[model samples]
Target chain A: MSNAERPDGWAITSPRSDRVRMIASLSGRSARRKLGMFRAEGPQAVRSLLEHRAADVRELYLTDAGTAANPDLLALAAAAGRRIRRIPEDVLRAMVRSGNDAPAGATGSGADGPVSPQGVLALAAMPEPGLDDVLEGLPHGPLTLLVLHEVQDPGNVGTLIRAADASGAAAVIATAGTADVWAPKTVRSAAGSLFHLPVVTGIDPERLLPALAEHSISALATSGYAAQDLYDAELPERSAWLLGNEGHGLPDAVLQAADLAVRIPLAGSAESLNVAIAATVCLFETMRRRGGGAAR
Target chain B: MSNAERPDGWAITSPRSDRVRMIASLSGRSARRKLGMFRAEGPQAVRSLLEHRAADVRELYLTDAGTAANPDLLALAAAAGRRIRRIPEDVLRAMVRSGNDAPAGATGSGADGPVSPQGVLALAAMPEPGLDDVLEGLPHGPLTLLVLHEVQDPGNVGTLIRAADASGAAAVIATAGTADVWAPKTVRSAAGSLFHLPVVTGIDPERLLPALAEHSISALATSGYAAQDLYDAELPERSAWLLGNEGHGLPDAVLQAADLAVRIPLAGSAESLNVAIAATVCLFETMRRRGGGAAR
Candidate 1:
């Protein structure tokens, strides 16, 4: 085996190096857009990126500990003929953006030590899946699409993406006001689900509603005050589950535009479910009605 | 009106006062235990605490903005014979611990501004509900209990508590190693559900399992790899849904002790669901089988 192929060779040790700073810049929305790349940090996300979207990965870095811990991931990347560079702890830490993985109120490398990226970081070309293309590719069966209408929390967006993937949704459509799907916090919270399905972002509601109508997909608005109970309603064969902002729910116009406003039954005194939880319940209920896990 | 009853007659303006520092220390686990008090920050949590558990609240503080924003809350507190004090923004900020209310990486009042507590904060004696008393009070009909087995994230713990309340669970029990139920982050994430149901913490599995049996409440372990599908299984009328740690999952011995092992069906390529999502799915499924929204 070549020395270059060994885990310890070709280390990047400087925290302030130009290349490390350039990679770290991907944490911000503008930098990602300018560079045409987004970052996937932590072991689970990087492993998924390598396994599912290996060709799109522009660069991969791992700390010495990261390399030792993820032998299988290294093997997978190597098999995919991807280059992996070993970086020092500081460099890896430098590339990590303060996000969901670190506890809140945690400042830079204080008593709790450095904020970790879980040993792996990957920069990949952001996949831009258009709504038209996503609609065109649907199979001839009951299909589900998860829509985020101005859901601003990055962590909630990421969790919703994972829920959409778990429930076998065809795609995730994020409105313009939604948190950047590529934000570091979203990527960390997504836990590798981003690589599993088509994610369309930055589309306006005006554009999306017409597109759904054109595609013959029913738009179901989830609300706490709706008259229709989700369980009692007859769900459409193909539908888009619309979840709105965390504080203010879907606006009146949007709710009116939807084919139906469905409310998840809150059995107790809770005024509403967390937007992410509400979305998951809706998606999973669709799965249950169509068929059980076997249908997936 | 008396000077004390008015919102702005007396104010706390100093962030470094002994009172502010003492309240700030409640953020630590040891301080909370030692003082037998925990904090509820932000408008929603404070409102819920006052409306639902007014007697338990020892003190309440609100900024000018908070008072202006929540006139109805003030009336509720007054009606309940609770004292409400006005504090300046700096003092309010000082009393808030580094928690979920603040975004990650936000250092002490840096470029993005101070970590806000959403204009209000409260200190309350923690409610210590016993497992035996909770079990004995269950209705004769179907009942649900949510169990967190060493789930460590404060945000996830809080979200799970909210989900349990939404699903009409009888109580939420946190085993040893779970996040502090009264931590600021958990309370914030819970949104207000903490006041709606009994939450028992610092429990051990050895004690929990026997307690469930005595109550004839089936213990259902939720796992990603369980043989029995959640939708397909014949669920018990009374049961405790067991959710394990984020990284390690439920210990094997606990899984063995469970009356049944249940798995939520994942239709997509994702290997598992988030712990909060998994617990919600299970709790909601119980509600679904018994009836729909009317069951509550």
Candidate 2:
């Protein structure tokens, strides 16, 4: 069908169609990089894209039920003059399956299942801010940056983004080896926070260090065995907190480059906290120190 | 083979055998209730059970590799005069599969996949502490308790327990609608903290309130929209913090019953924090207030 020929808006029916396959391919890193776009599924993420980053949204796909369920999103997309394609649920499901190897009808509830299709999907241009852009865009207040080094879990990466946003962080820098922040799973877990702040990805540690120094942003590395407690450490007005991988933690070279090492005191017997939880604790501690404790 | 007849110390080879079936059935809440036992899988959980709660361990199932890898656990079980049954990897895999309906030979990496067999399993008597028992066991210092109201995710429940332990909470109380604390997944997520503190499960809200009052412990309920911010709220020295379900925050009855409703201030546009993360933030904030900031 021609782009404007559909009588009742464009409808995609066949899961095996060329367009479906092309959309499905975006799930992979290479495909996303080549296409310079990523998919954001579910109402919340799509709404956030349309509302905050509408200029980046390329296409919107929705099931009939999805359209009915998300009136605000549909209206917002219409207001942005974006095309909306109504797709069958099975076709949407096939798109999700192409990206992930989850069993048919998995619904995203299972532990290893890819995130649920959530009945709506949008293709959007990937945001690729440079490291200099991130450092230069800092607000006038004390800068708080979150630096994630080699953190592998998409959920953890996304949660850190959300936590960073909530803690009033100026930006997030994901160094080499971190999960793709624009990946669908990360987008969903981030809950729209990805659009709120500057996010620079694929940065090397060597490049990241000098930029922080140039900006006078002191970097603090989190370690379970560090002698200095987080509360006791002298947090800088402008600081970057370095978080590491889930299993092995930050490499010694990264820790050595940090301005200081800090630990959260554990009163109980847990060997350690989850990486995301640890970052939240540190981020909020910094916020608390800056008199960010008063609530609205 | 008879229980005492195996020259190799009673090895189970068949997945359908009665012993294997019984051990696998403990994955269900009804089965655990009827059998008065639950399964703990993986080397860490089994080791914790042997080292801390050895008296409650009824049987230890291990593969040849598991036995070799966990000599300290074997010694502890042997010292406790517990029985050990060695099984092949397939039998352990089958036991996990039977309980979780994961595809045959599915090594537990999928979303719905049960935890991997981890080459070890142990059947232990359920630790069913009474509410009175939990209250009485609080340390002489100011008491800190965690009350989970109908929280359903096994991982979240387990993580909360671990966090509670790390924050030095005296005990955890899981109300009727909460996930089974002894489930294999929860046990794995808790990372052995289950044995480090008193955990009381299945207590009704009515019973919990009177117990808290009788102990002179104040209760704080967490709400995302509470008028009082968590930072501004005067957290009691001896208090029980109530966390609600994943989808719904605390029920109105529970909130109305609380001494105060407190919220964590969010500076960004994200709607809310994950339940477990919220609990950790609150618990650690309480710890910081108690001067638990000094690390070893």
Candidate 3:
């Protein structure tokens, strides 16, 4: 609905308002980097931010319908002592559109347009956890750390976060050239696991690998050409899986540096699994071996 | 590049040409149904079709650069005795756009636009395997059959097909309301697995469950609320995993109809795993139990 037709008490209605534009600008990398903030859209992500990292949420915008539909989220934000602004649908749409990197004149919605935020969006401070902090917090026992090397798909990055969280990983690390874990698509696809786990970004693989070894986390990589089968590989007590880019598998240098390279054992004609799928298989295998498969 | 700038060797240059439009029309469900054909975009999918299902391939379209970049695919297609039509980039783009379900005027390219075909597309007959045929052909020993009930995302459907193939399932069955297995996005996300295995579509779960029972294939469903843990469940000799929709999951009736309901045991706060991810975990777990995880 247009802003003019909104009922009373709508705090924001104009899509062109400065506030909306500012939130929209968060869609760009430079803007997010400049502001040290990113946009988290959809009720699931906003709710996650409120639940796990409420202090990081800078501004919360919800449509009247969104508030009505997600009273529990509203309560969580209230409990966090955060102010909630009710916006008109159009304003929310504008904010969502601005965050969308789609070129101008794009008309598709859902399948083609920017993700539908489900009437909720949040501008939150990016959590900048250092590699040292992540390492320090690591448990002495068996643990898994997912390392994405130049993985460019935001969806893959995000889904891997959720998978890691599901498989009970200690943390996720992204090397240089990987998709920003804080990107809107990643946030949505991650389905709020970004809040559940500590994610460190921007480390160079060359440096990250050796640093991980210092922590006793053996680096593991997957390859289609590898002779070692994943099921037979003896996973280390502390493991760091090194996932490569989408189009190219791990670079030779990275693969060479890996402690071990194993194949997932494709039974069919598919050359490989989606990066996330392959990672999950490895992660779950680690979990099962570490006794995570037992009933909690 | 514009069609006018292309060399004269191009067989098709005009996007508006009747032949181009005919192929473009296949993007729509009705058109695909009417023609009994579907378009498989990108070199990976076309290569698989030529390699595994060559007799089903009706038309092959490639660009000059595509031919050079994917000589192996070109060679495979030629070996299949299929005619290769070299089209200009504009024609390829137009065909890609027509297959895209994006609304008119949507300008986004990769992230927003329809998926790029990666320099090759093929028109091929849809493989219509029946449920009984799928069951009859099932291996007498340990086997897996992935069943999708009303799952609607094309990418998820495609990925599940690939996951099932990777996990070495006997076949994949989709219920009514599920995304069309032959859709362009499904074909792409499925990578080449669409041609690797038999997929039977449009079976009612209520009927499908009992039919599988008659064949001694147990029906299993995954749910967050289930009392049974997947890791401990006594997996049947012949298993069929029932996966629900992306949003609603399995209906109560379908869930009740299944022989067993087990949870994947989320370690974190994620309400559930993505349908494809969850399905893969189950498929792989079953594989692991049936000795599929052992080195080939």
Candidate 4:
């Protein structure tokens, strides 16, 4: 398509341009809601979006260095028929708050910022899959789902998503008061796992409980002080693990609603594990129990 | 003693002062090496230093608000006979590169800086506990130790320390090329767990392997491609789990030196787990095997 005909074909050079401002504003909830779009920065995240959810990617922006370094990703984006725009490094830097100058070769993981300027970024349509849609599309047998309640830290939210994906969880549900999973930091920390499965956000636990029951998914709330140890609990074949906020943990009402309340036993001086770590331990334990063969 | 007579009793008011420069410079390797000291920032880290290693706390600085909020820590410092000085918040901010204006009540955990200025900071002597000393001081019965080889992120290092503490690991040893465990960010991420266990730095694996052999601690190196799954491996009563850098697995030599190589079996599309999360899984598995009761 000719540059004039393509909607996203403008070469963005000015950091102060409206397009840059709009892309940068994806960090905020209102901006994401108004724009109906969110950003995935660096090669890994952008590549994952293009690879898994190509139809959702609206535009791809690349600098000379980013293009040179990510030829395969460019090819994938082209195959997926995404509009590509060339952007300057300064413009790319302005699109994110921190780590804009990270080395181009970095894997976009374990770095300082949520969005590293790895020379490439993408503006993707928010895939607001409905809870019923996700429930209807569940994989055949022994399903694992993760429910995040009031987990406010973006890094923790992202890490949990990545962990959930790694543990073979079918989908993730973020209840009200949770951090925005579409936030740049959350996208980066997820390390591209966000695109791997269905994620439903802005959910209410009250509505979710009955829906989960309809789906035959037992909700297990994780608590630090629960009398039932994690190992002793018989995790169901179809389970939804409820992880809570880092500081206050699951509210008493939510704990009461869960089919079972389980705790990861602590053996040392640390009072508790980081929520993400705790979630991974629980998810993997469930995976292990369902004959996923991780233990073998 | 009078303020003039006390070696560390100077009230710092200027951010540009030499004392502030020295404290700020602790972020650098050469500065830490030359001064033989590192910084512990925020109230939790500072309080831990005073409580556990009072002799290592050379000096403590606190703002009026900090002193007021942390009365117990102040009394502990006084009881430990460490030098204490009062400073302005601006002066405290000048001592750290970031989060100088963090709210006085914030836990100083999620602020936008490597080091959060919690109105309190301390310069503590680097307690380079000898390998023999750590071995001799090990708690009776089965022991767990964490050995970090070349892991370069300060946050990861700190989280690993906290995880190690939570898993009941007796101590942690950071090999060369690893992020400095004494760095301010590491201290903050550790959340005072550094005080709960002995940490040894700059130890060569060649020497450590022999020392571990002498102590009958089996070395288990973690890798992503290992044929032996973590769940199936027989964890020894006394074990040293070696975790490598974020980007790279353990060096071939280090992996070869290990008594056994094991991998955490991942079931999803995630190629690998975060190093801290991986370490936690391995450490807890070891705990589970040694009757630490995580699985019981």
Candidate 5:
């Protein structure tokens, strides 16, 4: 709201103060798709880019005050041989959506002409598709991959990413129907996984299956009432854990394409697990098989 | 917002629409201080209440049309033995905070309110604490009580409670600083755990220490850089798991008060685990110790 005063190298004053645009456009996968980039706010996200050496980063935008508040963010971009741009509050506020409402009106990534310009947003390349990499790309043998089939909530998608990242999964592959992992909320919910790991979105399961079959892996889908528990099954090393849409879950077609459906064990009366938690159970089970459970 | 024909009952309306003396007092714990009560609007929160069987469900206020669309809600309340009331739509819309910028004295739950109230809400009672069963006389056997200190996110609080419930721990105690497990968001996140189990808020660790000392269960604090990994530690049956705040983590006093500080192993660059996830890892570890791992 006030006139911006930033560092020497960056220009702080706005050319048009009253007529600022907010980029809530990052809310939609399509919008993200058009621009080939997404929004990243907060100190954690900024630090993640530095930690992972994110290859897609074209710009590092921040508030001059944000730079003053979060020196770690400044250190991050600087250490990575990147510059931090001091952006406007109106732009940042426009791009960011609080937990108040799920972002809406995602017509396309670049469909609209400058919907909003936030304090900091990036134009980065989409993570490349490598389904085979998901199956066998880790340092050890038989890596695990989390395959999300139309899981709609960005928060759920992001949480799953965070959990998957924590378990040291090979990668996360999202079908075209799943919520965009790069959406601002999903990215925020993912904490920093988006920066540290591979997140391939907008592919069809039809296209993904053959590549997975080539890797000699099994796709284990999670069902609410299936008899066996996720931990009960003899989890394999090269396994793809699939979590479906929230209400309908995976359609018959998606499940028919997978190896088997497993259930997370429930002792109580919960009709279901949150999609993120369900995915986490599946992922950790694989990690457990991979000796992630062994003492450090 | 249209009104549906109401049955021969009292005035059917939206509580949010009735612009009366609304207490937007979220400043301290006082407004929330009154246990067994809070406000929320949204499809998800309402659905969670229907599922949870919370006992103090004092009233069900709704516009006649809301009742028609979500008849399941009516059936659920009846099944739960709750009372329902219906109101007008214009009144209800007026009750809602239209935009994020809800001015004080607007008589609505906005910004902090849940998104989308389907013309209905229920005032439910916070379940009676189950400390009576767990700490009835401070048993001599091994006991593990989990304590959450100032975890601010309502969802995180709820998830932690779910983890506590899932692990079958004796009870979950919250310090004065922790988030409210009974808040609508927390309840939704807990997935009805609040009804089936005990989440005691506003307690002093000092009070619990003396109470549990009889059981000889030492406190195990968790920190990112602790000396030992939780998986490798020799956990006792009578231990207490202490998890701290999300942003700031556990305060110094809470950690210092603990018998030991342990860390979950991390092989990846994730800065930290979700507090709830970290607690689950620890609880499941304990469950495994108690030989529940054989269930798999």
Candidate 6:
């Protein structure tokens, strides 16, 4: 919900006004870059940001006329010490992105578009995922990682991240040129997985992959036409799953740079799979291998 | 696509007229149901209908300019022995649905929306799918089958069917009240899979599963909540994959009807997997088992 003015304290009212027309225009990558801020909507999204970094949050909004008076959101906001602003009901309706439209074509009435609700839409600083090294020796969790490269669609990016979360991946690396996972739609499509997983953005694997040569992590990139079948590859104890553009798939440059390039075998007449579907297949395949008793 | 009409012929030009008004209100499922027709836009989608006898043959339109020049489409229309009506250009633009709207989090200038192309919108009769007895003896091939029980999302239905085509599934069966797999969005999302796959709709599993049983085809439903894991399940020598509703999964009635309800194990935070994902996992797992080795 961009377009809201920043009132002095933590409260925001009637957000998404023409006053913040810049934020709406910031739907462009160029604009998001200019502001160093992006938008995220819905109760779940706002709550995820609060749980992670309350200090980074600036303003919060709730609908006037007792819209978001529910105890759960209130408890979360109160616990985070975030003040709430009262906005007109109509104000909150326009704050959502279109894909939030009806759950990806769930129904005919287009209920997935933005809904009017009394909820908190907050502004939080972008996450700092730190260096790649942050994942090293992270307890006893599954040693999984999602490496993204120049993926263009925010929905696919978000969905991929969501799959990664479901499959227990530890982090996502958004190489330069990929959609920003924090951009509102990607964040929303991710269904709050953005906060659950560590995301490293603006990476140039041209430079980053070389630095990990010493680690035991197997660097595998997904390609539709790769020579090595995904099921046959010797998966690493810990992994780095590299994905690239939806149509182009992995660039030869990146594929050559990776430790190995693997592909999910197909049995159909269709040319290729959707970017998100491909990512999920690769991510879950790794998970299957690990749980099936592959000695990691 | 809707306004233009010429029953029993192939489309020629990419017309922009007439069909524009028809699709706006016809955007939802109820409207489509009332009309007894659905929208089909884009060259890929148009080509698909020409290729398949799966649906009833009906009206076809093409822009005068795009009609005369595109020999390949002309050849296809001729092969199908259908007539083509040409329309205006402006009407064509308004008819195409704009998909690929940047999802919520991505900061991008453009958003994907509904696609209703003006070039060639067909008013085709929905196909009456294969009966239980007709499908009992599936022809020889890779032999993949999609079974749905009340899957509500037309888009997901469309997408899964498209994936079935891409992954090479042989036929798709939709249980009672699931989204019409042949509806415009499902057709569009399917990326022409309906042409290649025998989509048997209005399928009541009580009648069909038993038929499949008589044919010695094991029917396995994908269950994230089930006790038997997919990797561990003994997939059939020949089988059908059953996918359930997006909200409530396959009914216990149907699950009990199935020879086995196999679970797709998850190691991550998602309490449940999407129906499409779960189905794809089940299908691929079948392929894995068919490849001659037990999966770990």
**Docking verdict class for candidate 3:** acceptable
Residue-wise C-alpha lDDT for candidate 5, range A1-296, written one tens digit per residue: 11222345443345333322223454555656776766776677667766675566766677656666766665666666666666666545544542233332221111111223223454455566565554455444567778888888776787788887887776788998987677666776788887777777777898887777777777878876666666667776677788888667878877778787776655444446666666665665566556563321
lDDT by residue (A137-199, candidate 1, tens digit) is 877668999999999877789899999998889889999998999987688778889999999
Native A-B interface contacts kept, per candidate = 0.58, 0.40, 0.42, 0.39, 0.14, 0.30
Work out the TM-score per prediction.
Answer: 0.94, 0.88, 0.93, 0.85, 0.80, 0.76
Off by over 4 Å in 1: A1-8, A97-115, A294-296, B1-8, B97-115, B294-296
lDDT by residue for model 6 over A187-275, one digit each (tens)? 66776677776778888877668645545566888776777777777877777888888658888888888887877777665556777
TM-score-better candidate, 3 vs 6: 3
Q: Model 1 in CAPRI terms: which quality?
A: medium
The order by descending DockQ is 1, 3, 2, 4, 6, 5
- C-alpha lDDT of all candidate models, in order: 0.82, 0.80, 0.83, 0.80, 0.63, 0.65
- Model 3: number of clashes? 3
- In model 5, how large is the Cα lDDT of residue A141? 58
Taking the tens digit of each residue's C-alpha lDDT, what string does model 4 give over A52-151? 8999998888887897898887678768877678777888888874222222222212444443558989999999999999999896668899999999
3 versus 4: better DockQ goes to: 3
Better of 1 and 3 by DockQ: 1
Docking class of 5: incorrect
* CAPRI-style class, candidate 2: acceptable
- The candidate 5 chain A region of ten consecutive residues with least summed lDDT is A106-115
Report per-candidate DockQ: 0.50, 0.38, 0.42, 0.35, 0.17, 0.28
Q: For candidate 2, give the lDDT.
A: 0.80
Output the number of the DockQ-best candidate: 1
Write the candidate numbers in order of decreasing TM-score.
Answer: 1, 3, 2, 4, 5, 6
Give per-residue CA lDDT, model 4, range B1-296, as digits (tens).
22236544449778888888878778666778899998899887888788888988888888877877888876787689876788888888778753222222222114234544567889988888888899877766688899999998887898899889877888999897788888777887787888888899988888999899888899998887788888888888788999998777789999999998987877777767778878877887777566555311
Q: What is the TM-score, restricted to chain A, for candidate 4?
A: 0.89
